[model samples]
Target chain A: GIQVEQSPPDLILQEGANSTLRCNFSDSVNNLQWFHQNPWGQLINLFYIPSGTKQNGRLSATTVATERYSLLYISSSQTTDSGVYFCAGTLQGAQKLVFGQGTRLTINP
Target chain B: EAGVVQSPRYKIIEKKQPVAFWCNPISGHNTLYWYLQNLGQGPELLIRYENEEAVDDSQLPKDRFSAERLKGVDSTLKIQPAELGDSAVYLCASSPGGGADTQYFGPGTRLTVL
Candidate 1:
């Protein structure tokens, strides 16, 4: 089983600030995903970046597969972004995913 | 189109009681998954179904947990005589078959085993 570690166990910021969350895995992975668990307990898919970079709205993510690390960027954060962010991944053909502890974010107005 | 649908937003029961949760995946989706998330933790895969067949369930605790996806559209998870440690949020997600596509998740069912 692979290991995933997320940095900045908790973060608090103003509504308009920006922040970056990181995830590091112990091995090469064929699938990597970032998810946001909202206050209502819905696990929303944020990104499925096994490698390279992707952007959606004010959020973006980059995965350096060779380095076994990934980064999620939240620009101009909003109140709705307050939640626990998790990163999960799996090796090729491995059906089970290894997840990081998660980073809890709180955005205040 | 509707996303994944799960029933019983919250449930509280005794440690030895039996509990079940239901999930309906998105229309036309062929892959279904069940995950467990403890408080302040990430979701961990418990089972994965491709159509009517369970392709992966290595992480599922077979002693008291069982799941079924009949007819490939809807699924159910059952935990009999659950333990206090079984308290967690159960999440259901669905995705199109094959490829590295995104998965859609439903609002999880929170269970509290006393």
Candidate 2:
């Protein structure tokens, strides 16, 4: 089983601000994904970066396998971006993913 | 893609009652998963299926929980004699089968056991 820890349990920022959320895993994982649980409770897959960097519009993520950590960057955040951001990872040879608590983000209009 | 489809967006039942949640995974997806999410917490895996076989279910509470993936397409999770503590959001997700594939989730079914 792999353990995951998310930093800054809660964050509040004004619209158009930028923020970085981090996720640290106890060991190297075969799969790492970032998800956004919107206000409607829909879990939206944001990124699947096992390693290296990937960008999806204003949302980008970078994972360092050697360091066993990942960072998610949100630029020009909007009120609609407010939600719980979670990072989960599946260990080598494992089928299930262990999840981190989450980072609660609130973007004020 | 239509993503994962789940039935009964919400459910409310008395303790000891039986309730079931249905899930239809994305077409062609061979791996399906069920997760439990408590309030203010991330989702936790309850069971996983690779096609029609249950690959991982050690985390499922067999005493009251049971899940099945018939014909390798749709899934059903049932809880018999539900308890008050059984209240939570049950989420269904699907992947393309590779161990490293990304999983997509449904909106989830919110259950409230009185």
Best candidate, DockQ: 2
Stretch of 10 with least lDDT, candidate 1 chain A = A90-99
Model 2 DockQ (Cα-based): 0.83
Candidate chain B TM-scores, in order: 0.97, 0.98
Local lDDT at B60 for model 2:
99
Q: Tell me the DockQ of each model, to 2 decimals.
A: 0.68, 0.83
Q: Give the CAPRI class of candidate 1.
A: medium
Residues B1-114, candidate 1, lDDT per residue (tens digit)?
998999989999999999999999999999999999898888888999999998889889999999999999999999998899999999999999843367889998999999
lDDT of 2 at A4: 95
Global lDDT of each model? 0.91, 0.95
Residue A76 of model 1: what lDDT? 98
Model 2: lDDT equals 0.95
Q: Write the per-residue lDDT of candidate 2 for residues B39-84, one digit (tens) a residue.
A: 9899999999999999899999999999999999999999998999
For residues A1-109, what per-residue lDDT tens digits would candidate 2 score against the true structure?
7889998899999999999999999888868999999999999999999999999999999999999999999999999999999999999888688899999999999
